[model samples]
Target: MKTVLVIEDDIGIQKQLKWSLTDYELVFAQDRSSALTQLRRYEPDVVTLDLGLPPDPANASEGLACLNDILSLQPECKVIVITGNTDNEHALKAIALGAYDYYQKPVDADVLNIIIARAFKISDLEAENRALKSANVGNTDIIGNSESILKAYRTVEKIAPTEITTLLLGESGTGKEVFARAIHRQSPRVNKPFVAINCASIPENLLESELFGYEKGAFTGANKTTLGKIECANGGTLLLDEIGDMPLSLQAKMLRFLQERVIERVGGRQELEVDVRVICATHRNLAEMVAEQSFREDLYYRISEITLNIPSLRQRGHDIVIIGKALLHKFNQEFNTQVQGFTDSAMQSMLHYAWPGNIRELQNKLKSAVILADSKYITEEDLGLSARNAKVDTLRKVREVAETQAIRHAYTLATGNLSKTADSLGITRPTLYALIDKYRLHDLRNTETEN
Candidate 1:
């Protein structure tokens, strides 16, 4: 059954509300302090507050204070305010201060019941939506249909349930962090905290304390002991973003935690054990960094128990169109625009132009286009994209470039083998040779000559 907290000071109205709101498991509080206590204790789904309480029953100040406190404690709770029939200003003030809805005094139990019912319905819908979002983390959130991206998602699906330390490797703005979250949601620790810390973003002097935490007096301003990201994520997952940029001095401490599953707080003697699954992500090549001795080889090996390489947006064919359309719809709602979709020219430019900043760049461009677009559809100019370089605009030229690109990619994968290239492209050897000749792919000829 849904819970409702009624905060009213008047005895007659409180009794009437109790009798009327029999549908809900109701809890009552007379004033601000008691209302907050009941709010924390019951954590009710809905709250009906009287905008007149003790010490200032004639005014709305005390009631408004209680409303703020209630929301601060439980932001999701729907607060409905009860105000005087003439108290239009206070009713408006209550709505502005985050009251879900308002009811004018001289209680009509039937009318108030309708409002409460609607509030509960809305709250239930929101809760269901949150659940759907959490459940769809594995499937719906990571949007891509290309072969390369499919392979990456497949890797995530396989490795997410395991306890192994997984490393996500990709270019900046690629969905490495998204995959990390997908892993966490799919894991047993979904209910536990998933703490993320970016090594590159934090100052070197503070990164250690942020990761491993510090005891009181660890530093000049340290007034109280604090739990670090790793400790906070105990029994869950901890994402070490930009792991390659982590300071060398802190790498040893991280290595110790990984090896021992334990951490020592700064200025503390006791070692605290943590059971967090470490997931590291970085755009930099850890192998090369290890070779150059800039990154610790042992730490690299420890974190890379399994490595999943997320493909760049440009590499994922047709996914650019898919993600662009999705972002367009999202931004349409966000910006309150009625933009239908991207223009044909816009789609062409998006396909042809290299998205160097990946999904982040695509999102920002779409958001700008939606906000600035005066027409029903978003144009390439609105998105700030240059004209599709002659290739994409002309169908024949596009096919030619696409065919040659496919042949080149397949040839490399097939190690310049004629039969293998033909099979990979699903073409006969003669057709492969014809296309290779048509494109003047002299690299294949050179490879054959060398062989």
Candidate 2:
């Protein structure tokens, strides 16, 4: 049986909870000392914490200290804090400090049970996704099954066989590197070394040497002869991440490399030919950079034989739930917790929220949620989105401000039949009727409908 550590000072409340969660091995610790002892001995996956411990029951310092100690010992432990009715602000602060879910007193087992279940599910999902315990570790595996991701997969499949220089465009944290790796994985050069270099990270002076490699004595601290990423990727592929920030001089050199398939090592006279496929990616708008003369237009034209745009998480339907489930599983294994899964509300929030930081942010937030969540299902609150005001306002369509191209999607998918377009949206046929009337799309529909 799983263990639950209850940290409330009230004896009556403790007895009630111990009876409520009798299925689990129940342990009680009213103060910091007993709590630490029970925590060390039992190592409970979920803790029902009362933020009013003795030595300062009226103040939150003792309880907060206990919370920190639990986290420090087992950062993945699920700690559901107990707070006052109007102490929601403190609960939010506790969440920010990595508390899973906080409850408002007086304590009610039914409500607390719900929170605990959600926490368990979240913990389970996270445990399922983590690869191993190590620093700088990443889940290099491509992690989406949405139509948008499927489209990306298809694009990679189509371009992988060819030697064309492909440009991947997307917002940061949208898994540009993952897509780049996917392309390499499916390419002809899979057996060869796949080298990746961040073009924008290295200094301009050092960037050249990092890519083209430097000959010994090429520059200060150029201690020994070294092969650059491009040469190292010979007969393979090189992913130029953040390619938009590369210097124009380097862009010119890169264009030459693409054309000649040869690179001159920095400060070296060797003109070595390489058989490496080039894949470039950036979150920046290259067209804007080109117009500003911050980037080489000619180089952009050369490298962009094919372009793949990765969709953001918000655009990927149902993928949020998929990735969340995957993440919950990862944390479950990592922390050895029994977190169940996401609550319906949590799932809805994941679907509706605009993921500004994309997958990376999802992992971090879920990691905290899984360890802190106390229930079998992770509620929206457990995911740090419980505030009623935090609920998202739905994305509304504004035809008046929309582009002709935007409405064209509705029209095309509707098969250019205005009547069908209105039916799909569940609005009154006349409401769709009015939109078609106002948008001047009726004429275009008739012409296309006839065809």
Candidate 3:
């Protein structure tokens, strides 16, 4: 339930306020000291405070101080100020001091409730907007179309229909979270939240509370009750990234959560049943970890009802050019720069280079080149890979890279008409056809023929 704090000193007013807001978990604090304690303890999302208090009942000073403290400590907290009918100026001052809204007395429960409800609605909308932005704003988050990635996507499509526990296997920076989201997007719980937490990022001691949450007084710093990533993702998807690094002790608890679909806060006895789909990703080899007795064997089997392995960019070959072009187009639209195309040297350089950092590194390199390249046609020098030689290149291989990129660039520049793509490259249509055949660039042909 949404929680609200009322910091009014008037006995009759407080009673009416609490009784009116029965839908919320309302907590009352009569004085500044108690109010601050409750503010820290409850961490209520919406708060109603009176400008008059015990120490300074005739003045708005104490109330303004409380507002500043609450705003400073919890910037996201929404504070509504209550003031006497004669204290209109003080109420306006409260608004200047970062108050969410002001209510002038005599207290009208209906009007106040409307304002409070609107504040909560605004809070929820902001949170939802942030999630939408993260999930859909940019392709930079993760990208793939190679068979390996496509295979993983297909697995996600199939597994998302069921509540089966899924394990994603890949090296770091392979966009494991991206694949996890695809599962969430395809799942029955698509409309719900998709919460993710990195197991390896948090400290071992803190990871438990972060995943399952903790009640007030659960730990030294457990000032307020919190819904952990798992609980927060209820009726949706919860992704545990880098689960291989999840401590062995917590592994048992995680197994129990998966088995029962329930979790207990760190120091709370009650079991909270959560209806969430669990998806986990890790770089470590679980089989190897199990063999070494570092990972729980039973837990491994539980989470791995299905597994998808995301391949590195090196394994995908010339798909790098396909992705690079896509990225170039993305940046071209975003930055509104007129980059005609990649130069011959840059195109071959991209084909021959080994992308050790996978697609992420490729993205970073392209973003850098996009910002730095002086010409409409970015060259090998702009990519900063001119010094890196291809590990092994046959004579036919060297010629093939130039011809393939030449055909692709020509096709793209011509908007994919084969005759135009061919003429633009200063080659006869038949010669271009042979080169296209030799290079196995079918997608380019599709576009060319379509145009």
Candidate 4:
């Protein structure tokens, strides 16, 4: 049974509510303090708050403050405000303060129960949606279907099941961390923690302590013994994001940990064993760094046992549009906008533009467009892409580009099945084969035989 917190001070009404709302498991509180106590203890999804809460039942001040406290403690809780028949002002104020709904006093048990039911239903749905979104965050967040992305996906599929220390090579904002999470989700260590630390983001002086942790009295202000990222991720995965930016002084300790699967806290001499699958990602050229003597050669070889090079957005062909559309949909839901789709000009501009920041750039542009777009479809101006900046294409060139995009999109949707791709494109197998050969799509053709 779902739980409901009833915060009313009146004895007669409280008794009436208890008798009427028999369908739910109800917890009663006569004042603000007790309501908060019950709220924390039960963590009920639905709350029916009385505007005449004790210590000042004549004025709505105490009740409103209680409502504020309840929302601050649990923002998702559905707070139904009970008000006097003439208390429209307080009711509106309650709604503005994030109360779910309001009920007028001289309560009709049936009517109040209906409102409470609706609140519970909506709360359940929001919780369910949040749960689903969280479940998909690690697995389905990497959205792409282009051959380059597919190849990366295939590589992840092969390496995710193993304990090999994987290195993800990609341009910044190419979602190296997303790929890292994907690997962790697919691996046997899926149930365990996946801790990530950015070497560049943290100061060089603190990077070692952040990775290996420090003990109490290990250094100044070290009040308590703490577990490092590696120790926290024991039996799971640790992503050393931007590993290339790690300071030379700390690289030796990292190398030792990687080779021996052991780490020593800064203040402590104990060698703690950690069995974590390490994944390193960076935009820098490690080989060049090694040659330049900035990065250790032994550390380079240890992390790069298996390397997956993530393709830049410009190189992913039609995937730019695919990723853009997915992001647009996500932003629409997030911003509560009714954006149908992108305008033709916007679509073309996204396809032709050089996305220097890759998926991160695409996500930001779409988020802004979804919020600021006035019309049913988002325009190029909304995406902040100027027409003057777009490369002009001849009529024939435009036609060829459209055809190529269609074929590739259909081919990806069909999962490289030749017959399915041909049928989806409204062309015969022979014509599809000829077009594939004409376009020199060797990757698609090579993979099609396996399908």
Candidate 5:
């Protein structure tokens, strides 16, 4: 169970709160000193701080000081300030001092409980996101736990040790180069150079020279013989990024080099034997390009000895938040900011957004947010996401959606067997039937013969 620290000095109010909020593990502190001690002992994520305490029961001075102290020690803790009926000024002041929220006195347990629950839920999300970061600590380049990412990672592990040419297929900013480097690092030639060249970035006339190098006086600027990316890699790996953009005229030379393991430099006759492992990546469909005759089919077949498909941010599910949190921590240090986790609206926006640019776009938004956020927690505005775009649902609505999905999934998995579906859902047959009827799953009832 989650813990909550209650820092109210009034014995009656404390007792009333303890009686009413029985769902959580509650710890009480009557003053600043006791509050700090209890805070150290419990390290609770949520705290109810009364802004009128001993030594100054009539004012909020001591309580505000206590709030500052609590935040100083635990900046991530959610501190909810309780104030007098007319103490709006102090409540706002407390908020400025890093309090999570403020509540006016004449305590209504239902409202306060709702606030506390929200705090805990946010805390849980941050904790889970941080945990995901820790889980990927060993992998410096890739960060995710979703099945799609895991499947790609598994493929990398299997192919990294081999000399097979790899073709990475994914949208832009999906870390295709990262996987290329991973393959290089895991190969026997890791100690050698690992080079990458983007076919799309270089001019069509110059890409061949860039890959195979140029001899002295080969072109206007060729002052001396220079090693190209392919030769520079030598025994290591060379990643040909955006290979689909390679000029059709140059693909034959590339194919020849790949086949013969030798390259004739521009304006040179001697073929230099090269033993470099090759990896190719592209956001465009090579097969489609080949069908259009823009890309060489022979080169495509040679480069794609092994293929890995990277999942986009939308397809990775909860990995989006995990990667976002990881980026937030990274930019925090780089920009010298102490921004905490995202707000409910901000998280919902992130989840709902399509992220067409993938991790690159996420990194840009987070870097900007860290530098410009006014509050400790990042809001939806900080992320450059509009609240109007977010699909924010109530707790009841979320629960109902989850229930409906679960029931439908279980029923399909059980092949419409009523008893088996109930057993898989860990509910009684009667309850399963009632839920099916409640959700109006008439097709399932019509198909199944109540086994």
Candidate 6:
């Protein structure tokens, strides 16, 4: 049964509500304190808040405070503020403060019932959507169909079973960790631990101990010996993330461990042998750092036996729209908004934006748009995009670019065969020739024709 909290101090009206709304599991509170208590206890999806409470029944201060508290505690709850007939100001204020909706005084049972039912319906739909997304989004599967991503996957398939140390280079927020996990999953040591540590996030002093462990008396706080990440990941894989930021003082020690396949604990003389496949990832250029003498060249050569360069979101053609659609589904389910998809202008803007943060930035933008959108389709304004001026003038230009991209994609898929390209694009050879001429796509047509 759906839960509803009715926060009205009037005892007579409470009894009437209980009798009328027998279909719902109702919880009632007469004051702000009790209402807050009930909110935490029941965790209702719908709240009927009255903007008048004891000690100041004529004023809305206490009720508004209760509303804020409820919203802060349960942001997804649909709060229907019940205000006096002349208290339109308070109603609007409540809405601005995040109340879902408001009802004027002299509440009819049927009208109130309809409002509460609608709220319940929306909440249930959002809950179902969230459940569905949680099943897929939490997995380590890298989601993209772009050619760059496919090539990266091919590299991963080739290198996963080997014991050589691999290096992954990418722009920040391009799902390097996800790729790392994919490698681990495909490796022979899939059942074993895949330990990961961000070299830059931890303090320099603590980093050595974190990677190589310590003896009981290594430091003042060391009460017992502990295994480090490399030791813990024995017989498995160890991912050293943001390896460019590893302290110079520790680089030689790390290089020694990499060369010898053994680690010496802090303040201990005995060296312990460990079997671990090391995978290093960094957004920074290690080659430049090596030339600058900030990064050890020997260490770079040791770690980068095989290298995979992850493509940025902007470089992955048509992936922006594909990922955007997936995100729209996810956020709509999360926020309980029925946002269908992006508008033509919004899609064009997304295609044009540099997306400095890559997939992470796109996800954030779509999330905000989903929450703020008041229409079925998300527009450029909803996406908070500033480039909304040249919609009509740029339509033809955008179409041409889109057509060119489509031809390129089809050509690549067809392996540059003219007949296959024509068949894939559902166009006659003559029409294909005309398009190729119009767009000057002769380079794509340089391949063999199926005579």
The numbered model that scores best in TM-score is: 5
Ranking of all predicted structures according to TM-score, beginning with the best and ending with the worst: 5, 1, 4, 6, 2, 3
Task: Give candidate 4 regions above 4 Å deviation.
Answer: 1-139, 388-451
In angstroms, give how far residue 403 of model 6 lies from its true place. 14
lDDT of 4 by residue, 222-256 (tens): 99999899999999999999999999999999999
**Runs off by more than 4 Å, candidate 6:** 1-140, 333-337, 387-451
Residue lDDT tens for model 5, 335-386: 8889878887888888888989999999999889989999998998999987
How many angstroms is residue 15 displaced in model 5 relative to the true structure, after the best TM-score fit? 9.8
Instruction: Name the weakest run of 10 consecutive residues (lDDT summed) in model 1.
Output: 128-137
Which lDDT value does model 3 have at 150? 60
What digit string (tens of lDDT, one per residue) describes model 3 on residues 1-451? 6889999888998788778887788999988889989999888889999988889999988889888888988888889998888888998999888888998988887898899999997776565444434433223344545566566666766787888888998877677888888778777898999999999999998999999999999989889999889999989999999999999999999999999999999899999899989898999999999999999999999999988888877776656766777678788888887776677678788878777777788889988889888988788888888735645575568888888777777787888789988778888889888888878887766665545
Q: How close is candidate 5 to the true structure, as a TM-score?
A: 0.68
Model 6 lDDT, residue 59, Cα? 91
Q: Write the per-residue lDDT of candidate 2 for residues 1-451, one digit (tens) a residue.
A: 5678889899998888877875677889989999999999887788988888899988788888999999998788899999989877767878887898888988677777788888876776565444222211123366666667777777887898888899999988888888888888887888998899999899998899899998999888889999999989998999999999898878889889888999999999989999999999999999999999999988889889999998888788777777777778789999888887787678877877788898887888799998898887788888876433345443333436463454566667888766665555556657765766676667754655632
Stretches off by above 4 angstroms in model 2 are 1-140, 386-451
Clashes of each: 0, 39, 0, 0, 0, 0
State in Å the error of residue 70, model 4.
Answer: 61
Candidate 4 contains a number of clashing pairs equal to 0
Instruction: Answer with 3 or 5, whichever has the higher TM-score.
Output: 5
lDDT (tens digit, per residue) of candidate 6 on 1-451: 5779999999998998999898898999999999989998888999999999886899999889988999999999999999999999999999999998999989789999999999887886786455445423225467666778878888988898888899999999998988998899988999999999999999999999999999998999999999999999999999999999999999999999999999998878998999998999999999999999999999999999999999999898667777788788878788888987778788888877788999999988999888888889899888877654434444558878998998888888887787788889999988988999999988866775554
lDDT, candidate 1, at 21: 81
Say which prediction, candidate 5 or candidate 6, comes out ahead on lDDT.
5
TM-score of 3: 0.55
